[model samples]
Target chain A: MSLETLSENRSFGGTQGVYRHKSQATGTDMTFGLFMPELAEHARVPVLWYLSGLTCTHENAMTKAAAQQLCADAGIAIVFPDTSPRGDDVADDEAYDLGKGAGFYVNATQDPWKPHFQMWHYIVHELPELLGDNFAVDRDRMGITGHSMGGHGALTIAMTHPERYKSVSAFAPIANPTESDWGRKQLGAYLGSDESAWRAHDSTVLMTEKGYPGEILIDQGSSDQFLDLLKPESLAHAMMARRQSGQFRMQPGYDHSYFFVQTFMNDHVMWHTERLI
Target chain B: MSLETLSENRSFGGTQGVYRHKSQATGTDMTFGLFMPELAEHARVPVLWYLSGLTCTHENAMTKAAAQQLCADAGIAIVFPDTSPRGDDVADDEAYDLGKGAGFYVNATQDPWKPHFQMWHYIVHELPELLGDNFAVDRDRMGITGHSMGGHGALTIAMTHPERYKSVSAFAPIANPTESDWGRKQLGAYLGSDESAWRAHDSTVLMTEKGYPGEILIDQGSSDQFLDLLKPESLAHAMMARRQSGQFRMQPGYDHSYFFVQTFMNDHVMWHTERLI
Candidate 1:
């Protein structure tokens, strides 16, 4: 669980750091970013986990999200993990959506992809333990949020482990991945074309089986080019049938870009802070 | 000048756009980023020019500085220019400090760099006029700021054309560039070894000769790795001797990174907003 500091800087009256560690889940060196507000300088604070989309590293959100000042003001810590296990030895595909940068945040069950594509385990189990041990983050009060593929990760992970995460939110999440083209291709490659097995990692399927007791928040851009791939409307219908409550805000004239996420980032931080603190 | 929209996205309840245009001053196509807050949707807003440091493109400040949210809140439009004229035809040196990304905001008199390294004319005259013609920016209400080399550009440009810029500020500026290695090399190469001509583009020299009537604002990181190269102390002395009133607050335990800039970006935005509005 020992972490190596890649870089650290004072940002937004707090510490913004990047660290690398050997991961038991992925069996590779993993990098992650952490932002601890000034309040953490005195005492432990609630943490909000942020997972980036496909082809994004920890630096994507760290550099572009523009959420640090809001997080600092809210006195919350944020942890951003690399989207996938990365190394020369790690198995990868030439496609941007399937390999290297795209871990899909699932424990792969297929060969050539099963060993190191264990972001699900790395993020859900190992990373938290490391953070709780090494950083001033309150383990009891944790929330999760992310964008696109990472949004799917946040939703599915939160629902599966209801006791671990107190609140959950997402931006432009692929709400019903099992039915979408992207999901079918990725799940087929990683989980071996077993639709039954994918139910365990699909937010809509999992929620329909056993509804989440608490409310969720999601923001989607109406003008997003990938709106069809991210079937939010279908998810909303499924959640309605399951009796789960949440807010799905569809912003107009926005795209699936960091700009769209940054526009409403402060609101998301505040929503989590109110619940976490 | 005609400009083409390279890309545009919604951010912080506004528009973030990148544009490319053929520049008469530099004789090359140049790109710049613009952030127009929601206020611009209703009426013209004050414009702020942000010049980036050495070895940077327009994207550096746009992606990393984390200032757009604050600028949107303050109802200011920010224009970020490329540090240098960049094209395959543009002359360049092998070194990072002397070539493409390091324009030093000067009009080169030397052979190879002379044709396309006309950043002095680009920033002081052509860019502003182009912005005024194409955007919803109030031409009379404009302020300028930058980091390091760009910071030097802000100070020198604003002082030289005080009537054009309503306010000026900088982050980790190379204040006494005439006395630093970076300045000597850049000025020697660009202006052809004429020490006397360098004074025209030196902030310390300009301010000493004719003090700025309005107050200036500067933020310096005490722990900056290039603190010796960016001699704020020398600028402070020159200002005091010339009876110029400005605040040079040396922040403790900060560095020469976007992290430090983002920490104090809100304050700088507010400073410019107050004077411009």
Candidate 2:
């Protein structure tokens, strides 16, 4: 429950704080970066949680997204958590997408990973609870957004717990991880061979089964290398089948990289702010 | 002088291009990232050259600085060159500061570094030539900025060739390297023990010797761990002695890190835009 202030600096007329806390779920110290707007002095601000993708830590979203200015303008606080629990003792995979950098925002039930890879619990329960207690965040006005796999995490998490998130969006998210190679490999290893369980975490399936009341905004790049694996069409089909009010837009000549994310990040922050307000 | 386009993507309603070229200076394939605003289609835009500090490649500023939106808003293009030349044939030192990451933005006269450490020629001359030929950048309207050691680069380069740079700024820059441990170590190794020759690259000394007609803007964090080494007062004194209009602000409770850079980056972009326009 104790948090260590690793580093704190003032940026863009806002305060950026990096904190480390021993996670009860992961059994390791986890680090996250938060940007609190200057407006926080007047009243509690809406919170936006950003999940990063493969080969990324909390630092990626914190540094690269270029989201703070818009968040500051919109009077929103942003939190960035490590992609996964990491330590010399913590288990890791040689592959970039399976281990330390790839939490996939799922509660792993598999061996070696079950103990420290409870990212679902970390993001949804532990992180929000911690932020609410320490920072002046409007818990009821929380929103979520992310890049790539983190996009998938935001979509799935928000869809599953609509009451917990007032808004949700993604940048080049893996729409149907249940059908993608990354999804099949990660979900199989983390949740076992049960295809039924995978559906619970697949944003497309979640959209069809339990429609989100609020609009689900997604931006996918046409040039993204992972387009074959992301399959945004599946989510589009699911939304249409369910008569979902969410909007899924495919951006032209973009990729599944930070360049794409940074380009559209302000719009995402603005979108979340509109809903949070 | 054929450039190989490594990657290109659209985001935040702009184009991010990564390119590599076999440098006649560094004698290796050097990489740089450029962000072109949508406004470039209609008119040639002012350019901001961002030089990174120690242990950073072009990737650091490209991924971490979060300057693209501000650049886009200001209708400015950002060019980030790799910190130093790197290849199997390139000479290197075990220390992070000296060998690969420490080009020092000077034409090295020493043996091992002389051949491949031509960052001065690369950035000041060759880069502008290439940008003029290949990109929609107004060569006549350009500005420079950097962080830490790169701050030193921005100041020295702009002052030395005021014709090339219309404005200049830095974030937690090492104001007077001649008086700092990092600068002395790098200068001694790269430029030899000739203390007089070092003045050409020392911003404070350059300000006193060759006064800049325009104002210089700098933001230094009061809590920066390297404040003792940075010596902002030395630079301030030199600027004052020369009667140069410079804005040197010491921000309270900040540090010499990217968090500090991202916080005030918009101001730098806006500063350059004002001068460029």
Candidate 3:
């Protein structure tokens, strides 16, 4: 796939670039934001892929979380992929929890949604191949992270492909789709109401089966309004029951907003950098 | 001078709050952002005021620049004031330059604008008093900084009121508003056609006459789109010519966006903190 460089700006001794490309996975034009540290120009660098939450583009975490300075210091490249297939030709939904912004990182198996809602392939396959070919990304040393819905994507995807991604982290992630109301409803629409098929895409279920080989990092806010829906405790319980050596920090007085993410971004970046390098 | 708390979020062990109040100076409601360090809960701490650029609100620098953790580490509180008066009743122009977002930080002396465009008084007098009374602010160790038009606000205000502000800094500030086209035109509208009236508000002219009492720090991106309009070299030259010691860094490959501002924000906050503390 040919990539189009939309914009690039120097940030914290790195290049923060916005790129667009034709995606065969989603069958639409997709855009992603990237922050390549100075190390990438000189030699290959480990990359941390950040998936955004609902109703967010590549700009939200790229700008709000401000991972460049830490990533730059650690000589790591950070990539931000879109939440779902976009553009007018793509499928639409009236509810904020079901449609364009809510990909749930799954390939749709139903009509009106099957053609474009293939974010699972887009993120897990197409984008990674594109990045590995174009950028100085060490495929062996890649890590995955996200916020909320994207956090669901990160955990499930990393759990499924532990051999590909070396590390995994999340901020206020949806621990289980099958247990979540909106998540269950959306997954049913995309996967044809097959509850058994949803098990492979659920973090709590997957973690209970075979825990991730490496330690996982999770930061959930104590004051998040969406705390009930997220159900991070269920995943933490599953993780602990499986004897998973993960770090689950419940930050007090924090919320679901980027402010909460920014407060602990340095810790996450450094954690990934430590394992990545 | 009663302030209504619009919103407050916990950030970096501090409180990031958005407040609104009926301004006696502007004759309309004004909003501002404040980040009070946790140390302020027990004792008064030094405060830094950040003025935003044109086409920006108090939220822009607060969210994008992200100066909280560093300020928190240094135990300094920070405040953000609005650029201009707002509401349906206030006078506005079709253009982005001379209207609501472009207050130019001046007490307008011209028609239509004279009634509500009293930003100079609001920022220099009303805000300081309100902050001092409400927050745990050390009035004697206050500092000021801003970007673009707001940078002009910081430079001119700090120079004129040296006794009130101890340290000053800017990021690509308009040096001599009287010489620049938009600066000259906007100043003419806000302060009548008399060019002599603008010298007091121009950083170059102010620095040339009596230089700031303390060291000033300016970080201008070498690749800034508004390089010509900002005229940072003129301000640097004037400061140097007056034997005014300051730190003027030309950051290469950076632009005028918040990306650039965010990159150097930690440095500016630290610089202000060193002087403030």
Q: Is the docking of candidate 2 incorrect, acceptable, medium or high quality?
A: incorrect
Q: Of models 1 and 2, which has the larger lDDT?
A: 1
Model 3 ranges with Cα > 4 A deviation: A1-277
Q: Note the residue pairs that clash in candidate 2.
A: A11-B263, A12-B263, A263-B11, A263-B12, A264-B12
Residue A89 error for model 1, in Å?
90
Chain B: TM-scores of all predictions: 0.98, 0.98, 0.98
Residue B251's C-alpha lDDT in candidate 3?
63
| Reproduced native contacts, each prediction | 0.00, 0.00, 0.00
Q: Can you list each candidate's DockQ?
A: 0.01, 0.01, 0.01
- The candidate 1 chain B region of ten consecutive residues with least summed lDDT is B239-248
Worst 10 residues of 2 chain A by lDDT: A240-249
- The digit string of per-residue lDDT tens for model 2 on A166-226 reads 9999887888898889799999888888888889899888887897877777777756788
* Candidates in order, interface RMSD in Å: 26.5, 25.9, 24.8
Mark the regions of model 2 whose C-alpha exceeds 4 Å error after superposition: B1-277
Score residue A44 of candidate 1 by CA lDDT.
Answer: 97
